[model samples]
Target: MTFRDVVALWLVKEKRATDVVLAACDLLVAGEGGEAVARLAALTRLEADIEVPILLPEVMRELDLPHHSRGTVEGREEGLRAMAVRVLSGELTPRELTKWTHRMFGHEDEGWRLSELDDAYDTQAVDSDEALDAEVMAEVRRITS
Candidate 1:
């Protein structure tokens, strides 16, 4: 009915989805952020090819939303490493590891992960035992001499 609505419909029909998002972003900054987001969401529902990191994120940033494409890779790896340590220490069971890995990494199956952690634990346990043996031997020699 209105000119703005007509242009928006045209942009969406033409598959210029990014332009539609830009228009939505302007509406949002004009204190209609909610309505703009709803309109943009409907238009971009099935279209994933639009990469308007600029306009869409402007609205999100203004609204204090997390707008990044992906989370930090280093942080995710560090969390997994800490979780592995807990598993090796027997503080976390295999079932718990599977559950947590599923939630965090979308990995529902963890056979290989459990095997790797078990192998690492065995290697570290052996190294610790060898160090303790050397220390006891040194103490014995010192006491005898």
Candidate 2:
């Protein structure tokens, strides 16, 4: 079944008739594009948190939800850009930036991938005990831009 079908079923199962959910599902089914998908995804995350694990992977490929090792999925660029800003502002340290970037592109809990970020994390050890703030920030800027 499609994502909208799954969402519609879930809404019925939960006995929910929220206009936002229905509207989002309708828009998504009709191929309305990113905003609708984002709205529906946010609604699902908020209203049906328990179902997200199953619902996301099984039904919502269009969402391109992030897995630990997935390369260059949606939102990663924006997130990295934001992190770069944080790094520049000193709100987050280089180490923390590395951790976040590694988490985005490397093994976190159960997933790993062959990626530039993973290679950097391995060789530079930026996520731990490495004072490579400038380097990490530059990399973040490069990728994000």
Candidate 3:
């Protein structure tokens, strides 16, 4: 699908505040010439107050990609073009992109520390309610003390 078509689909399917944010991120990362720019412009007109983060680094890591140094404009353009191609070709879905982004940037509870917490919370780790309560009490004490 064309870039605009994908954005439209996303809007219709998701229809949340975050969907707009995701669409803008996709457009900026894709950098598919004027069309992507145009969509961003339209979105800006619709909601001039929204905040957009510079998520290039997160996007790059999610795509198992790299960033272009600021020394070369050409390199930056090339990286954006590669990102655009991946998004447009359906090689990367927005949800997958978002998840990868969260994991890469530590936005989600999937990092090493969070994973350790999950492991600790597993049934095998705590054999009874008393153990769980003790763990929680210890954490509470650590935080308050």
Candidate 4:
């Protein structure tokens, strides 16, 4: 595999390990060794990126990152804004942008994002969610008239 893919894989693994260790520490702090063991065992069965926000301060400390950092959030918002611009410019397809938005932001409403773009361009909404409603309304009027 390429260096980029390998680096991504390593980061994923590191995050999972950190999560598992943090989980154990949490349970131990609560005086639940048995629960810790059980939870740790279950975690070993799954390959996932789990994050406990309350434990993140410690994790950030270990990583030499500030506990309360806005740079990351601001950077992410800028990235999404850039992606929106690309979609509007046809540099990225709507389908691809929708997928990326969902992956990046977890359930961001794509139609709403597209609507923002339509407004920005002073154009009619393209590929609108109202297509079905408009068609159904047309049929209803036809039947009534």
* Best of the candidates, TM-score: 2
Q: Tens digits of per-residue lDDT for model 3 on 1-94?
A: 3333333333223223345345555656676334434444354533633422233334334434444433244342332233334444666543
Per-residue accuracy of model 2 over 79-98 as CA lDDT, tens digit each: 45555566666777766666
lDDT against true structure, model 2: 0.47
The prediction achieving the highest lDDT against the true structure is 2
Q: Candidate 3 at 16: error in angstroms?
A: 8.3
Candidate 4: residue 143 Cα off by (Å): 40
TM-score of each candidate structure, all chains considered together: 0.26, 0.36, 0.21, 0.28
Ranking 1 against 4 by lDDT, winner? 1
Better of 3 and 4 by TM-score: 4
What lDDT does model 3 reach? 0.38
lDDT comparing candidate 1 with the true structure: 0.43
- Badly placed stretches (over 4 Å) of model 4 are 1-71, 108-145
Alpha-carbon RMSD to native, per candidate:
18.6, 10.8, 15.5, 16.6
lDDT of 3 at 73: 43
**Residue by residue across 108-141, what tens digits does model 4's lDDT show?**
4323443343343334355453553343233223
Ranking by TM-score: 2, 4, 1, 3
Clashing pairs in 2: none
Task: Tell me the tens digit of each residue's lDDT in model 1 across 32-113.
Answer: 6574365564456345245443345554555454433324443343344445444455665544544454455553232334
